[model samples]
Target: MDPAIEAIRTFNRFFTRHVGAIDARFLDTEANLPEARLLFEIARQEPVQANLLQAALGLDRGYLSRMIARFEDRGWIMRDRFEADARTRPIRMTEAGREAFDKIDQRQRAAVAHDLNRLDAVAQDDLVQALTKARLLLDPDAPAEFIIRSARIGEVSQVAARQSILYAASHGWGRELETLEAETTAAFLRRFKPGREECWVADLSGTMAGAVFLTDEGDSLARLRLLHVEPFARRRGIGGALVDECVRFARDRQYDRIILWTHTVLDAARRIYAHHGFECIATEVHHEFGEPVQGETWQLRLTA
Candidate 1:
């Protein structure tokens, strides 16, 4: 079997076991996991149409009909015909159903808390971030929120390592790039200034999705360094957002010009720079990162 397919199957199996999906009872509730999920969905989307529920749950028509009948018989749900359309009916939870759902919700929360409490604070945070990334990967069109904020403690090293890994994977760069990133990151922290220099990290749902650093280069010039977006978080405007924040910060700091060095292979980043009115100032063939590449310097006049 293909490695990717096998990996997915393994994850599915593990998740099912972790959630006690094979158990006769879920969260010690009277209903199994699927039935509990249906109840929760109904509570969440009260007055939801039967067709919408079926589509959302991807349930078989006969199975859903039987489930609805069972709920109605148990006095757990009530269905009402649409006033405008006699053929359509919406399903909603009864008082008893809501009470049952509350129990299930509490149990679910407790179960999750029990699992998370086993790990330390950092490990819990890591698990949440990993799950968020996995969810985003599985649903590309899902809505996402990103925030640009100053880097926190220990984040500089994290950003540097991420940059090294990304460059190596995307451009086949060697350890030279990693060394350069680490040195530059260290310098930024060592000579950090409150107002003149800044490092911004793009956070997406609790994970560090991207980062950029703006540092004083003397002569009223600011240099943008180590701009990178994680591969999983690409195509979400994160790179552009990081660049825009850098430009905004530089302009706010009263810099006359903002500059950055990049390569021809980084077309996306180049486009972002151009979009922000940066112009190519110089280009030269350089042997770095174990390869010969055209290194280009770009600058934007902040005064204009």
Candidate 2:
């Protein structure tokens, strides 16, 4: 099996076991995990159509009908036919069912708290971030909340380290690239100007997803440097967001032109630049990052 698939399967097994999801009773409740989940969903989205519930949970029609029948037998829920559509029935929880759901919710919250309290604040945050990213990956259609903000203290080092590791892993670049990134970041910080130079970090739902830098190069010229996005966070318009932020900042600072140096192999970044009206103005061959590679300079003219 593929490593990714195996890893996911392993995590599923561990999580199911950890949560007692395979047990006959969930959180010591009378209902099993699936039944408890169904009850909670009904309580949360009451008056929701049975078809909608089935679609949302991806449950089989027959299986869902049986679960609904069980809930009805327990006097926890009622299915009422829609006035306009006899075939469509909405599910609602009874008073007893609502009470049961509340109890289950309390118990689940307690269980989660018990587990999370074992970890420190940082570990809890890491767990939450990991889960959020995993959920986003599983649901590509979900909206991603991205923020382009000023780089926080110590974040410049983070940017350099991330860029170095990612380039090394993906493109087989060597320590030369790492050294260059570190030096550039350090130099920018040493000579940083509040209004003229800026570094922006792209944050996606509490995770540092990407970063970019803009520096004054004199004579109305601004240089864009060290543009990078995390590999897993690509294709989500993060690269574009970073570039857009750079251009906006440059224009606000009254720079006439913005320039950047990048290699030819960075097709995605190049595409984002081109989309924002940047033109390639220079090219050369450089063996700075281990292997021979074509280097290109892209420039964009800022309009007043």
Candidate 3:
């Protein structure tokens, strides 16, 4: 077997045992791991559909039906039909279910805290960050809320350097990308317009997850520049939100159109722009980033 596979299996085995994931009664609760997990899923997102729950957990329909029956019998959850669609029944946690979930949640928290308390503060922080990164790596849409806000002068100015470093590790890009980003951002700062131009940053837990800038082009045209999301922050709609925000700002400012220049390598960003009604107007071979590549020009007509 490959060494990497063996190492991953070894870590999985150790972590599963450490977390008591295979325990017959997880965390000393009456519910087994599966039952406890189902309860947690329901508690976090109550009024969830049964089909969604089954698909989310990859449980068989029969098994999920039985589980729902068990929950209903225990008065933990109640199933009710939709007003507009009697064929659809939504599952909601009852008062008893809330109590049960709270117990399990509290117990799990205490157990984890006990283990974390053994480590020093730095070690604990490192472990937490590692776990967060692992989850993001495994599931890009892991439901992280990045706070989107107007970029302050200091924060907006730093995006060029931050973006340069952020993409360098993944794309193996060099000073060329940095220089391009610096020039555009520098120009944006120099030609600042109070309400006509703006930059927004998507902040995740005090870190800049992504950023985009809107700049006036003197012809009733607003151009989106420096649109990027960190790799760890992708698949969470951050890029799409940034684009939507920019387009909305352009429409509000009465711009005739919003245009952006992006590379063909950026499939995700292109999809986002297209989704927001940006039509590809042009493409050309360019060495802007020190590499011969197809660059794209996408524009959205705001009059519509």
The residue pairs that clash in candidate 3, if any, are none
Q: Candidate 2: where are CA atoms >4 Å away?
A: 1-10, 83-87, 137-143
- TM-scores for the candidates: 0.92, 0.86, 0.57
For model 3, residues 59-125, the per-residue Cα lDDT tens digits are: 9988888878888888999878545652257888999989888999999999999999899976886
lDDT of 2 at 160: 94
TM-score of 3: 0.57
Better of 1 and 3 by TM-score: 1
Expressed as tens digits, the lDDT of each residue in 1-304 for candidate 2 is 6999999999999999999899998888878899998887898798888888888788998898898888889889977854666328788899989888888899999999998999998899789878877876687556788899999888899999999998888899979999999899999999998899999998888878899999999999999999998765777899989999999888898899999999899998899999999999999999888789999999999965
Provide the lDDT at 3 for model 1: 98
What is candidate 1's TM-score against the reference? Answer: 0.92
Q: Which number leads on TM-score? A: 1
Q: Give the alpha-carbon lDDT of every model.
A: 0.88, 0.88, 0.84
